[model samples]
Target: MVNNNEKDKSSQVTEFSKEAGYYLQKGVHCLNRSQLKKALKYFRKTIETDPHNTYTHYNIAYILSRIDYLKDINETFQEILGTTYNLPEASFLAAIYYSLTGEMDLAEKELEKFLEIAPEGEIMEEAREMLNLLSGEEEIYENLSYIKLSEKYEGVIQTVKEKVKRNLECPFFRVKMLENLYQLDDDLTSNIIFLYGLAENSTIAERVLRHFIKSSWAKEMHKELAMLALRDIGAEEPYEVMMENRIVKVTLKEYFERIPQWEPQWYQVMEKALENIKYNKYHSKTMEGELKEVWNQYIKVAYPEIPPVRDINLWSAALEYLTFKKRGINLNHKEISLKYRVFPEELLEKYKEMGQALSR
Candidate 1:
């Protein structure tokens, strides 16, 4: 026969289970309400007894991120990564954490692995979008690193040539490697002209020139190459390619006498390049608070009549903010609220001043 005391004890245990379950549900509700602190307390209590609950682990991670507890966030992510429990949730959260902490390689690996396991993950759409953005950023960094490495090592061209022969096509590495070569070797100018003109795979060369023209050294190299290939070789067709592709700035026009054979098409491309440069120059110039003061007066005079539009102020604010503040925009748009409305000249000037101060 069951003893009355043992029955009472069993009842007490059942009541405790009910209490714990209630608290766990309430904790989740609190998190949904953005009551981070209240949610944290209940979650902590539930996790203390039910340590293996995957939902509890995921929720703690979310709340930790909200409160900006980076160390805790990373630790929680490590835990999520370890779990054989709830893979889709684990991977999705793990990817986010890895990305936030700038462990992009790890994040990418986790995301890819996640897709393999759960191709249609619960957050698959969001995961794909985030993956696209993160991978793009990784590609940029990888490309930059490759450029730097190629610049550092003289043997990079041979290495790339070998890779190309092996049918290894890393667009990022190839494009940057070509750029480094163009900067270091004048002989590469002919190669550059040929690559841009006659090669079937001209996209890499095109990208190289796009990145090259941004730097003074590369821009000068491009000009030199243009003069050599266009004047000495009398390759009017290639010159047309340069101009048509906007391979270099329009300022190179002064170097040539009669335009290339395809003068009409060439001039048209130059016109487009000049227009883009002009538009960008206007934004940089009119944004009176941009950190680059060298071009400030030139731009101001160049577009004297152009109004100080909201875009101009925004561009100025963005440049100064990025250059000086080094702030990251991970938080909600409303929380970091940058006003995008139009402002009068007086207001614009005030904002510019504010930007300048923030820049300093």
Candidate 2:
């Protein structure tokens, strides 16, 4: 007969295994619901119980890459694949890593290997498309030259179009390419706004705008999109473009009805003008009249109760900072402005040359 101690140990092992399975299932449920944080907690519990589970390791790696915390990711990918060389998820993820790091040929090979194993799943379709993109057999993005973007980087724009066509699921990649296109000429960026407006998917348009909103041009486009969404969707509103940036509670009819009015409670055409003026405060002839008019009128009514210029400045500055970051520019205006007494004008001017030329 087994000793009591050995029996107890065996029982404990069974209990731990059961608990690990429970948490793994819970984690999957959370992932299905898009509760990534909760999913991660459950996954972590599973890891603590079954440290050697390669499938668990693969799940963790996939989540990590999605959140963009890919430090030592190469090693993690290696660990997962090293444990289970034939795992489809492991191969697909490894291919993605390779694609991002410029290992196109390796990425294609890994994806092809994955398709060979699981050729019927949705994942297989994605892998096949990625393979086409990596091999340059099909362009990644659709050519949007008909949209009338700037001509300066026609070649790069074509490349971007190819990338977009190939990987429709990767919002980050699409946004990145649009950014590169915009840098070559602001006119192209402006045209992107128009192109994006024509997009059937709001998520895609949002990605395009979010990628570039820090720039004056992109912000201008976003304001346009916001208006389009408002007008097209018929959002209810009291229609105040608050001195505050946050969308205040309002009605759709009110917003539409007030667009042409000059009443103190509502601002319509002036919203875009003022937004432009905030960044381009030291304006050229184009912005001077409008800025001065809004500044003079707005401060008179909202003085003492108004939010500080510093607040507005900081907000716009934060946006500018985000744009610069997206472009791989190192300057952080918030810190610089606080520490050395720098101004938006200087930074604005630097980007303006690039920002203004995006489109005509």
Candidate 3:
């Protein structure tokens, strides 16, 4: 015969457990969908309801680690460590985080603790491999170079190339090829672009340009070249906003001047140039000859002693130097002088005067 008070407490505990399980399931569902914020909210509610839930703690730490929220991640892992409950899995995950961040000493400590407490399972094998690598007992690099590794994956490369050649317009195929080649070698990655350039498929070029702009791995030079290729084909207007934000006026001036006055692409080039010039008032002179005259008149009015240069290239380069300096960039006047065929002393003097006026 159990007491009534004990029965009531047992019922309340069971209800709370069920509610915690429900929230945990919801959190896992949101996490799988990559709704990290929502998942974190649900996980927090679960923690509030069931303070002893190790799985929820692990999930919270995992999400925090993935997002690189290091402060919160460290606190959460520390909380897990302080718990009396055995969570060897948490130690394993901490080891991985430390290893990725190059904290080899902390990683080794965590890995050793994980191996000491973790139950025998598939993770044991993984833990052993990590320990061996950390201890320098195993040579992690059997091949050493991507070149040698690429030979083993030649079939994968050929398949991607075949798919790309079969349907040059298929962005999926091109993106897949780029991904595969990028993993293999830098030369292979460049080869994909070279092949596309030779084909002169404007559509393919546009797709590749957008892909490069969005990719984290693509260098600034790659993005610039992609934009230049698009500009050459007059497909640049679609990316006008991105171009306006990223490209320097000197580069934009060259792009607009080099645009061919042909039948199909002329309007696109003119429209893109006009739109960009309107948005970036500083580059109005670079885009339109009439605007350049107006700018010279304004400069003559403001500074009567400093006469404008007759050479458009030198003027443009000077403007670029001024803009660069205004943005706190350290300018190499000698390099600019050699590149633009302007006297370094003259360029430096103009830059100093421009800096003074700008300061005022």
Candidate 4:
């Protein structure tokens, strides 16, 4: 059923993809051999041909970090994370980047994400050490200013109470100190976790309580106590539910200061639409931010009586189309919808709805 012109076009596209794959393999091989310059050479070639390849971009970010070219690494890192949510290595690297930059809150949050998702590996141990380092609780990993002070059961407990009373240490340090003591005196683990849970850093407390529940260091009773502490803190995965569909674990409040009062579905739909943009031609960081701004603007006027979506991909593609249209780019809606696996008619309908929503 295909015509000669379509076949030729498909053949050229396949050949181009093959060229990109060849460069990617060469880059990986050179990287494995510790040939840094050659690896970068090939990786750059891969990016030129297949700019949206996630692993190729990740390799470049890794190399850039290794060579101390960190100025633009965050932008590169965030772009990769946007496309691939399950890549724990990016999160681990991002955490280290944040720590070096003195953004402890972001660093700790990234490390928690890495620890939660990364399976058993050498990186897992390193992530734990990084957590300790970020908290200034250990003398690990080079000659960092932080040092491990020796602890005795009685002395450590007394120090914890005295610090809590006098406010000698910050909330994070106080929690880490209690964690050390919890290891020393298993019998008082519940009491220690209770103190730890109420340490004012609810985020860190919620994180470590779950760590205790999973780690072998905590006894069964200690695990129960950790769970109780978690409940007392009242922190749960997915602080809110999306009435439109399934659950998303992230709390957008961390990302947005004053989250819109719209239903959670709009947010989830936006995220799904964004996810659908990964590895495509529309996956630039600037474009992603612009699309989000578009969503925010659209939702501002459309909220409270906004339309529901059965196909988030169609919504996503239409979002891109609408943004292009607003920018006067004149992208073909039919072609865009086909690329996103939706009907042309449906995409146009959604795009019109979005435009009208913004008008109101």
Question: Which model scores highest in lDDT?
Answer: 4
lDDT of each: 0.42, 0.47, 0.50, 0.56
How would you encode candidate 4's per-residue C-alpha lDDT over 1-360 as one tens digit per residue? Answer: 999888767765655555676566555455445555565567656656654333333334434444434235555445434534445566765665555444677878987987887657446776776677667685322111232221111112224434443442466555555555456664345445645544444665666665555554555335434544455566674333221243223332321222334455666767766776564564555455567678878876676667776677888888888876776777777778777889999889889999988886
Candidate 2 Cα lDDT to native: 0.47
Give the winner by TM-score: 4
- Clash pairs detected, candidate 4: none
Candidate 1: tens digits of C-alpha lDDT, residues 1-360: 999887766765554444455456555455445555555567556545444333343334433444444335555434434433444556655655555445677767877877788786555665565566665532222333222211211121223323332321565656554654555554444344433322223444444444444444544335444333233222333332243334443333442322211223322322332233333323332222223331233233333333343344344333333323332322222211233232344334543554455444
Off by over 4 Å in 1: 1-62, 66-73, 79-86, 137-360
Give one digit per residue, the lDDT tens place, for model 2 in 155-234: 21235433433454676646554664476553455445434433434455545444343344434224433444333323
Models sorted by lDDT, best on top: 4, 3, 2, 1
TM-scores for every predicted model: 0.23, 0.28, 0.28, 0.30
RMSD of 1: 25.1
Candidate 3 per-residue lDDT over residues 238-329, each given as its tens digit:
45323434533334334333322223232232333334345443443323433333333335334544444455445444555665455455
**lDDT: worst 10-residue window of model 3:** 147-156
lDDT, residue 193, candidate 1:
45
Clashes per prediction?
A: 0, 25, 0, 0
